[model samples]
Target: MPSNPTLLDDQPATGAPPSSPSATTIGDLEAGLDRLQSQGPPARRDLVRSLLPVAAVVALLCVWQILSWAGLKRSDLLPGPLTVAASLADAFADGTLQRAVATSLLRGVSGFAIAILIATPLALLLAQVRTLRAALGPLVSGLQVLPSVAWVPAAIIWFGLTDATVYFVVLMGATPSIVNGLLSGIDQIPPQYRSVGTVLGATRLQHTLLITLPAALPAYLGGLKQGWAFSWRSLMAAEIIAVGGSIGFGLGSMLQQGRDLSSMPLVMAAILAILVVGIVIELLVFSPLERRLLRRRGLLTQGAS
Candidate 1:
C-alpha cells in the first residue's frame, strides 16, 4: 500500500479537466508496479556466464556426433557436426547464407515495424474504451497464442505468393503480442496515479501518455520482445510455405531446398542459421535493452559474475 495514498475519494472537488499527474505520484505508481511485478532479473552475468552458452552448444554438438557414430540413422540421413559445419562453410563462401539471412531479416524487421504501428493506437484505444475493451479483449488475448503458421493458408489465398502474403502472416502473429503487452502495462498501473492525474486537471490524453504509458514501460518491453519472436517465426513459416522464384529466397527457402536435395548437412545448417539469427537478436538487442531498463529503474542489483 502507498503511504498517504491518493484515491478518487481523496481528490478535491473539481470542475475543470484534470491536470497532469505530479512527479511524486508518478514515482509512487512506478514503485507500486514494481511491487506487483512477479519476476525479477537474474544475477549479473559476466564473461564466464557468457561462455556457458558456448559450452552448452559444444556439448550438444558432441552429443550429435555421438548419435551419428552410434548409427541411429544412416550417415546419409543424419549428418555429423563436421559435415554440417562444412556445408555451412560452403554456403558462406558462395554467399548464399549471407543473402538468405539478409532477406529473412528484412522481412522480419519490416513486419515487426508495421505491427508496432498498428498495435500502439489499437491498444491505447482499447485500454481507454470500456465497451470496446469488454467486447474484444478476450479475442485479442487469444490471438497472441494462436500459431503464426495457421495464418499461412488464408494469407496465401488472399495475397498469393507475394511479399504481401508474408507480411500478413507476420502482422497476424505480432500485433496481438504488442497490443496485449501495452494493455497489460496500462492495466498494471495503480489507480492512485489516475486519481492524482485527475486532481492535477490533466486531459485524458495527457494522463494516458504521461502517466499510464510511462508507468507501463516494463510490460511494454516484454511485449516488444515477444512481438519480435512472433514476427521472426511467422516470417520463416511464410518463407517456407510461400516459396516463389519471384520472391527472393530466404533462410527457410534454403532449408526447403536442402530437404528437396536430400542433403542432411545442408538442412542442419539451415536450421542452425535460423536458430542462430533469433539467438543473436535476443542476445545483442533485447537482452541488453532489458538489462538497461531494469538498471535505470533501480529494479536490478546485478553483481559481477
Candidate 2:
C-alpha cells in the first residue's frame, strides 16, 4: 500500500499554533517592557519640570555674583551676593543666626499651633450650629482682613512685653483665618453628602469626623497655611515693637539692631533670613502636604507635577 499520511501531516495549516508556556511568558514580558519604555519619557519630563526651578535659582545666583563683581550697585545699599553670603557665614560662626532662627521659629510655631487648636473646634461648632454661625460669621470674616500688626498694641497691653505678648499677637493674627477657612470648607460641603451619610446610619459625630472632615480637609489645610503665614508676620511685627530686656533676641530684633547701627548688610541679612525661613517651611512642609492631599483626590493635574 502507498504510505499513509499521518493525522498531523494531513491537517491543513492555518497559521502558527498557540505558543508554548515559555514562549507566551516571554511575549508577555516583552509587551510589559515596551509599555514601561513608552512610559519612561513622561517620568523624565516630570523630573525635569521639578528641577527647572532649582536650575533657574542657580542661574540667578550666578548672575548676581557677576553683577557684584562688576560693581553694578553700591555695596552698602545693594550689598553684593558674596558679601551677603559672607555675612551669613559670619553670623553662623558667631552663633547669632542659629539662635535668632530658633527663637523666631519657636514663637511662630508655638503661636500657630495654639491658634489652630483654638480655631478648629470653634469652626466645627459653628459649622454645626446655625445660631452660632450666624452670630460669629461676620466677626470671623471681618477679623481676617484686619492687619495683624494692629493686635500688637492690644497684646502688649494684655500680656506686657513678654513672650506671652508675642504669642498673643500671633494667635490673634492666625486664629481668624483658620476658623474662617474651616467654616468656608464646611459651608461648601454638599447637602447630598450629608444625606448619604444619614442614610448610611452615620451619627452626627461620625459623619463629621469621617465624611465631613475628609471632604473639607483641603480647605482646612489651606486655612492652616494662611494662618501660619499670618502668625509668622504678626510675631515678627510684635518682636520688632516689643523687644526689650526681657524678650529674647530674635530675627526681628536683629533687624532692629542693624537699623540702630546703620548696617545695611545686617538688616538685609535679617530680612533675607526671614524670607528664606518662610519659603523653606512652605516648600518642605505645606507644599508637599497640599500636593499629597490634592493628588489623592485627583484634583492635582499633570502640570502640577
TM-score of each: 0.82, 0.82
> Whole-model lDDT for model 2 versus the true structure?
0.86
User: For model 1, how does the per-residue alpha-carbon lDDT over 1-305 read when each residue is reduced to its tens digit?
Assistant: 22344644555556443366668878988999988985765555687877887999999999999999999998989989988999999999999999999999998998899999999899999998999999999999999989989999998888888889889999999999999999999999889988999999999889988898888888998999999999999988888888883678899899989988989899999999999999999989988888888877777666622
lDDT of 1: 0.89
Off by over 4 Å in 1: 1-45, 301-305
Residue pairs with clashing backbones, model 1 = 18-201, 18-202, 19-200, 19-201, 19-202
Give the clashing pairs for model 2. none
lDDT of 1 at 83: 89
Query: What lDDT would each prediction earn against the true structure?
Result: 0.89, 0.86
Top candidate (lDDT): 1
State each model's C-alpha RMSD to the native: 11.3, 8.0
